[model samples]
Target: MDKQRDFVLRTIEERGVKFVRLWFTDVVGTLKSVAIAPAEVEGAFSEGIGFDGSAIEGLTRTYESDLLAHPDPTTFQILPWRGEIDPTARMFCDLTTPDGQPAVADPRNVLKRTLAKAADAGFTFYTHPEIEFYLLKSDKPGPHGLEPVDRAGYFDNVPGGTAHDFRRRSVRMLEDLGISVEYSHHEGGPGQNEIDLRYADGLTMADNIMTFRTVVKEVAIEEGVHATFMPKPLHGEPGSGMHTHMSLFEGDTNAFYEEGAQYQLSKTGRRFIAGLLRHANEIALVTNQFVNSYKRLWGGDEAPSYITWGHNNRSALVRVPLYKPGKSQSARIEHRGIDSAANPYLAYALMLAAGLKGIEEEYELPAEAEDNVWALSESERRALGYRRLPSSLFDAIRYMEESELVAETLGEQVFSYVLSNKRREYEQYRSQVTPFELKHSLDII
Candidate 1:
């Protein structure tokens, strides 16, 4: 704690940072901030800044609206996208009640609480996300179509590619803000991109995800383009997903590793994967929260519709990358359904909780699906006892509403708020008319 405070102060002095933004996320994972002068950093750190929480979505009731945002000094970093004049820095924050108790509805706090449970179990959860998004011409909402900045496919290095330049600048900006990028390349769609982050502890990864989106948008604005994390931004194309690799560890040893085991997957790791497959349908709403999310999930382009696992199979919702000989630490599971638009805090919390529950219950692992599960007919899948995930936003919400594991993982406040908010969104969306409806019905009728 002392080291972080000193580093925070030293960074401000060295970087000529005049304003420091204390950032936090609401329940739905929108980044919110309050700027403070350099001289006020100490006081702000000691006594958190107060804000009316009721104004923020899914924060607090009007009567108990006053909430405090306490900055986590460890997250301090300079805003590289900002200009030299009055340069700014930012740090993620934790929201709390005036009495110093953690605010139940705060997404970050919810993750922290779930992490505490893992800590009690003597394990640390690590995550690395392969986040895919798009580089569009600008934010202009077109008439039922998206304008791509460049026509590029997976790993296509178009020289002088405007989208590539934008990605390079975005990567540099993220590094300047203390985020380590693993790789950045064009995705399997026109004007699509993927930027993967190095693995880190779940809480830090959540913080990094919030920062990553902001940096991407900031760099896009600076480069006179627009970047979007919307799942299925275009029709008849591969949709973007945040394929996350996760593992659990005990000190220096990988808890999920076992020697001489089939596929070198330990019993613990298999159970964890079982837990994920068992609960994935119930928690799908949290990971893919938007209406467009189902568009990606059900698009039949690599998205897994059924609950299944396999070795290095992209069609399964959970996959175990082939274990490297003598490399136990590298053993991990990848969840492919989560989109980049998810609330990382809630998503990671539920994931860890489900895995831990598996460990605790010693859940039996299922057989692997070698063939492409997507190619199999419904009867074949049914014969294999495979179950499909929720098909739409409303269906996901219906499953989420009854999930005891999800509720316990997110705590009551967040679970309730998320369900209510998503239901309302689905309601509003159902009431709205769309171009597709007009085109299909108006002329025909």
Candidate 2:
């Protein structure tokens, strides 16, 4: 800890950074910060910056609001996206209450608690996310209404596509912030792109995700464009998703990997996948929280509507990826349904809970569906014991509200808060009459 503190202090002095932002996130995963002079960093290191927890979403209520933003010195990074004249730096924070207990409702705290459970079970959770998003001309309504900035298709490298430049800049910025990018490419939809981050522990990956969104938007704004993580942003095209690859570790050994096992996945790995599929419906509200999120899920193509696992089937929600020869460490399950807009901490917590439950119960994994599940008739799917995910935000909430696993996983405070918030959103969505209804059926009905 002293080493990091000294490193940050010395870096500030040497780099001539004018402001050091103490960054944290609200419960919904929106990044928040309070800037301090370099001289105040020493004090911040010893005692955290004080803030009103009541002001932050899903934080404390007004009565008991005092909170602390204790900076994690390990997260310190100079802002490469910012200007050089008055260079800025930042670090992620851990929240605590006045009495120094970890804030119960903090999203990061939620993940930590889950991780602690995994630690007790002698497993470490690791995650790598392939996050997709769109770069729009602007979010504001235009004469022809909202539109995509380009008409490019999958992997089309336009000579000077703003998307290409934006992605290059975004990836570089992420590297500068200590996050490694494995790959970046244009996606199926115009202006849509995917950036895959290298695998890391769950907590670090969650922090990286928060930083990733900010860096993407910051670069988009600088390039006179806007980035949206909205699932199904364009009705006719593929939507953004955060297809997460996950595995368990015991020290340096990969728990999911086994030599000569089917797809190189161990028995424990299969159980974990079973757990995810078993509890998938109950946790859908967390994975696909937004109203439009369901739209993407049900939409044809890569979006997974059914709870099934496959070796290589893109339509299945959970895919056991093919193992690369001699790459035992890379064996992991890819969860397909989670969207980019979710609070990563909460999403990850629920995922770990579900998977760990599978391990504990020794749940039997279902047969892999090699053929496309999407092509099967509804009746056929039913006969095969395949179940569809929640069809709407309301449906997801209905399932989540009754989940003891979710309640236990998120604890009392967050489980209730998320359910209440999601219900409110679903209610509002149900009450609204959209342009689709008006344009298609207004006169006909």
lDDT of residue 159 for candidate 2: 88
Report the alpha-carbon TM-score of model 1 versus the true structure: 0.98
Q: Write the per-residue lDDT of candidate 1 for residues 1-445, one digit (tens) a residue.
A: 9888988998899988999999998989899988999998988789999999999999998899999999999988878777798999988899999999999999999899999999999999999999998888877867757788888899999999987788788888888877899999999989899999999999999999999999888888877888899989888988989999999999998888988887888888899998998899888988999988999999978988889999989999999998888888888999999998999999999989889888999899888998899889989999998888888999999899889999888888788899999999999999999988998999889
List all candidate RMSDs to the true structure.
Answer: 1.2, 1.2
Q: Cα miss at 276, model 1 (Å)?
A: 0.6
Write the residue-wise lDDT of candidate 2 on 309-358 in tens digits.
Answer: 99988999999888899988899999999999988999999999999999
Residue 312 CA displacement from its true place in model 2, Å: 0.9
Candidate 2 TM-score to native: 0.98
Candidate 1: residue 198 lDDT (0-100): 91
The clash count of every prediction, one per candidate, is 0, 0
TM per candidate: 0.98, 0.98
Which pairs clash inside model 1? none
The local distance difference test score of model 2 is 0.92
